[model samples]
Target: MEATETVLCSLLAVDLTDYCYRVCSRCQRVLPSDNNGLASSSFCNFCKSKEPKLLYRILMSIATDTSVKTVICFDRAATVLFGCSADEFFHFTKLNPLAASMVNQVFDGEMLRMTLTRPHNRNAQHMRVTSIVPLRSGFQPAIVTLTHICTKNASLGNCSTTNHTLRKGRAVVLDDPNEETQTALVADPNQEKSQKKGMILPFKPLTMTFHNVNYYVDMPKEMRSQGVPETRLQLLSNVSGVFSPGVLTALVGSSGAGKTTLMDVLAGRKTGGYTEGDIRISGHPNEQTFARISGYVEQNDIHSPQVTVEESLWFSASLCLPKEISKEQKKVGMDEFYLIWLRYG
Candidate 1:
């Protein structure tokens, strides 16, 4: 058997036996058990509490693909996994059977990197699951934070060799792939070397700026055919702003304020709208290439209810991800998408 200070292992199975134990919430000590092998009281002998609150800790067995299994206990990683505290999880399981079932699904078939320490007994090694990492199949969550896990806030941006900027007084549609298909985002010269050294550098962020942006829908041709004068409906007028990188900008307005219409025009989703003014990315006119890396979710639930969540994510990843990404990588990306949706949906 191989022995090391740190072991990167995939979870083969989780032992649900003695999965949970009750402890005094104040003193953080295990409480007495009743005849049924369930926690009898929340009282702690060490602290001597008249009325005690209780909490639970989860313990499970984890292993590599072909190695001997070892027992590991959850700490803050429990909260990270389920995005809730242990007390909350206990209450959730008691209240929501479906949510408890969902929690159970996470234990098996997960990959983690563990740091190992040998006890005085020396026969078996104990390990703590320190951090989650990508599995051999490249399945890894794209964005995880203390507040949220597996969020869609992160996405791939389009790569272009030739830089384009927004020109003044231009309202050009950016979905024409034929015009900029030859260019791809060039990789940084240091990225390869850094990856080889097991470090990944963050990509450069793009800054989008739109000035005096306006959109109008022309009157129907049939309406103009009669003596009626041709007129256009202005959806957005003289909207100017810079969406700088690393800044949270909210587009707040009353109904019919054209917030949605402005977004549609920027995303190239408006087919019949006439646009004016300039939309620049990093001081250059944005072209069709920018659309390659852009992602947009409709405000309404327009997808079919019959389609499963997995199918929907797979469809999106297939279309949005770069062609160079392999099918296996895309599958991993979809796994991440599913995890995020489960928490946020």
Candidate 2:
């Protein structure tokens, strides 16, 4: 029989505390560890293997904005989010203490969208975190206002000028509580008329480009002390690529071929790596805005085991779709179209 499932969307109100786990050296099954956080130096009866390897097991307590908190016991979600197995995470932390510290900073004050499962005959629950999206506390209103103005200005044809003027007017109204904001948003009809009369071009497709990219990370002191000339290890060298709109690209390579390193560099996700090169979108350098507009999925199965298929669709639609769309329209699009197709198609 299948297990029951539950889905939770909440702020990670506390830190993700990690514990040491022991696994059989050969078979890789979890084993009991001693107080030193090391597994017994004896043979493992489960796999008849000798010795045990230490791994990192992550756990966290999460709460909604209302302060309803629950302690989540992690299974695969931690592995997916960390981009490595527990054993690999432990080893990586050991080798790169700086990188480990940088990673720890990602947890506090992030929004967690996770899925949980409950077995039929047991009280224990399991969880998988599908996403960890960082929320900048005070930036939403400004971002929404800018996006509205940009959309109005970029749309082609007869309505563009009127729409832009109206949006600017609305901005002035909404921003009236702040005197400086009101002054900044006051529309200029003269400028709008001049811009409209000159030229109006259709929206252009965005193309992301990276040229002659190189990335390196600091090497461990032990390696440098052992007479290694370079204190920094180069992960990628002279990589060049272009990703045009509507084109599908794949980065494929064997283990340690720097595929992930190159991707991380282009996505602006690498914090501990030393990078040098041009990464641009539509002739502009990539920035935090790139991260806001692009989505990257890690190679892990992350979904709420308890959420119904329809509930999952609703969850995404409500959070991801444009707020300008009416609630009725959004529901119709989901229930009448996307949900139906997903069920029968």
In order of appearance, the predictions have TM-scores of 0.30, 0.30
**How many clashes in candidate 1?**
9
Per-residue lDDT of model 1, residues 1-345, tens digit only? 333466554443333333455766666556787788787876678888645554445544443322334545454555555445555545544543333333323333344666654444443344544444434353322111101111111122222111212111211111213344222111233433443554333333455667678888887788778756759867788887655433466989866788889888888888786899877654457787777767887786356779987787777677667789999999887778778888998
* lDDT for each residue of candidate 2 in 1-345, tens digit (9 for 90 to 100): 334344333333223345655667787566655787565555677888777766455555454322233444433554435544554544544544333433322333333455554445453443434334323332121222333333443343212221211223221222222133322222446655555454433233455666678898898798888999987898898887666443466778776799877877788789886998877664457887787777776554355979997788777788767789998897788778866687899
lDDT values of the candidates? 0.52, 0.53
lDDT for model 2? 0.53
**Which 10-residue window of candidate 2 scores lowest in summed lDDT?**
158-167
The candidate scoring highest on TM-score is: 2
